[model samples]
Target: MKEFTFELPTKIYFGTNMTEDVLQKESAQFAGNVLIVTSGRSLITYGYLPKLISIIEHLPGNEKVVVYDKITQNPKLKEAQEAISLGKKEHVQSVVGFGGGSSIDAAKAVAAGIASDENIETFLLNGREPDGNVLPIIAIPTTAGTGSELSKGAILSSPAHHIKAGIRGKKLLPRMAVIDTSYTWTVPERITCETGFDVLAHAVESYVAVKSNAFSEMFSEKAIRIVGENLPKLIRNPGDHAAREQMCFASMIMGSNLANIGTCLPHRIQYAIGACTESSHAAGLIALYPSWIRHEFEVNPRKLNHVFQWLGYDPVNDAAQAEQLFSELKTEWKIPYSLSELGIRESMIEDLADQVTGNLANDRLSEKESIIRSILKESYLFRQ
Candidate 1:
């Protein structure tokens, strides 16, 4: 086994109704002012937001709770700035991320900005590091994807610059993470399917990542198996509580895997696609998976075979067969398989490839521009 080190600083509370229990106990450490960052009114419409507020308001030393519900999908840097302004104005001493990955990512940026009192764009766009003055964060995931609650990275988009990227730091990890499976019970079928695909992507990419070690692969393999066995059950019967629990667990562990080893080409490419198009993050990844799998099969067949076996497929020596199996899985889940389906034009492929940023060290392929353009073209015209 290769030498490696791992650490997870976030205190996790996971269960059916562990949300109230965790918040009730943890909120005591919060200051007089708190900020709740969310995507929209879904939490309120579903009563989760109100319940969270009630719990915090009744806790000692929590005199005020502010809600910032303007977060959107693929959260923008400006959104984080706005949220930070709100948090600073309200004197928020702590932050709560109360929804999906987008909400949680925005919350982390807000927390960093509020405490550092600096433009978070420097951290997101440039290579500036946080000064370790970030406010404490509590993460409550409403969906079983992204795993932002347990991650030390925050993905934010800059609309003006036409870039979407991540800010990573140990200080960004939440002080507490509440993983209540009940929150995912109300997720729409499409969202559940897409988010489940996100879990699968995270595991597959991390398992093959150049930085992966024995310890991270342990979590990656288990998460892949769990998502494969449970995602389809949840899709067929959305009321499968057992499957829901398994997926939720899988998502959290995958988050830890992501934090430790990180992802490869698919995630990096998707950031560019997200910056250019209105495609959902999971949709872009699903579209790119066939090409990514084919690449892995060529350069790292042994690792790809492990992933195939965990997904219940017989060992295959052929790259085409490996790609086909993944294609079939997405088809079964009713996900789109081509970038064209997500509004990518043939002319836009080069620009998309050029926009891709961040480390590609985990990918086996050389980070040549021609190679990236070819991959984008293949994903765009795949099966068209």
Candidate 2:
């Protein structure tokens, strides 16, 4: 049992009606105006945003709610800075993240930038550390993936630099996380598959990361089991609220687990892919995870076996069984099986490979460019 230190300061409100039941009460924790960071039109179209706004406006004080919906897929550093600038101008004292991982992460970055004079660009590229002076953030996860609600790392992309990195510190952790399964009930089937895979990636990668300890491993194991059992069900029947609830819990657990232990090759590589091709983060992971497991299974057979067993597969000699499992899941879930299908050109392989940092800190994996290139090649095309 390796030594570890852990603390989760975020207050979590789980189950149904959490948002409408406690949004104003929780928002009252911080005085002054509040900023709501949201992404895309899904939540807005679903009317979640208006309902949230109504709750905030009904608060006791003259607390104004400002909505910033400029967040995009693979959230950009400039966007976060823009949000921070808006928050500062509005005299915002707190933030509410009201959508998926991108929205929540952008909100956290905005929170961090509000606390410091250093811009978000400086923090992403120059290795600046946050001073824990961030405005309070309340995360409401509308998606059952990325686990951004419970995580302390806010992933941001700098398009000019073509880099996707995270600002990780205890300060980025949400002051409150509201997990309501009702928010995820309307997620489309394809998105369910994509984000569902992300949930599994966090569980598996964090469990096998070099920094993993007894506490994180326990959470990771449970998260993996929950996802393995429930994701497929939810994918098959989007109306399964019970399965959706389980997935929401698993996603939260994985988020907390990743915050503590970090992730391995698949996640590290997916960042590079997302930066290069602007592809879906979960899609890239789905394309690469099996190949990665096959490549590293021999180096850490015990860990791989544990994962396989938990997922109801038996890999006697290698990751063949694991690969087969995901392949079947991909076909059943109708997810694209190759990067090319996701619009990543094969010609950009070297560009993608060059961006790979292999900074997973895994003893079984190397950060070497040659090794990363090899993994990319294997993952470029789907093998039947």
Best by lDDT: 1
Winning candidate number (TM-score): 1
User: What is the TM-score (0 to 1) of candidate 1?
Assistant: 0.97
Q: Per-residue lDDT tens digits of candidate 2, residues 1-384?
A: 668986777899999767777766664664578899998598889899888888887877746889999899789988998999999899898998989999999999999888787777888886565875998899999989899998988888887898888787888899999999999999999889899889988988888788888998898889888877887788768899999999999999888886777788887777888886677789989898767877667577788788877877665575676666666767766785687776777888888877866455663566444767777887788875
Model 1: how far residue 216 lies from native, Å? 0.6
> Given candidate 1, what's the lDDT at residue 191?
92
Residue 114 lDDT in candidate 1:
96
Show where candidate 1 strays beyond 4 Å.
367-369, 382-384
Model 1, 27: alpha-carbon shift in Å? 2.5
Q: What shift in Å separates residue 366 of candidate 2 from its native position after superposition? A: 2.0
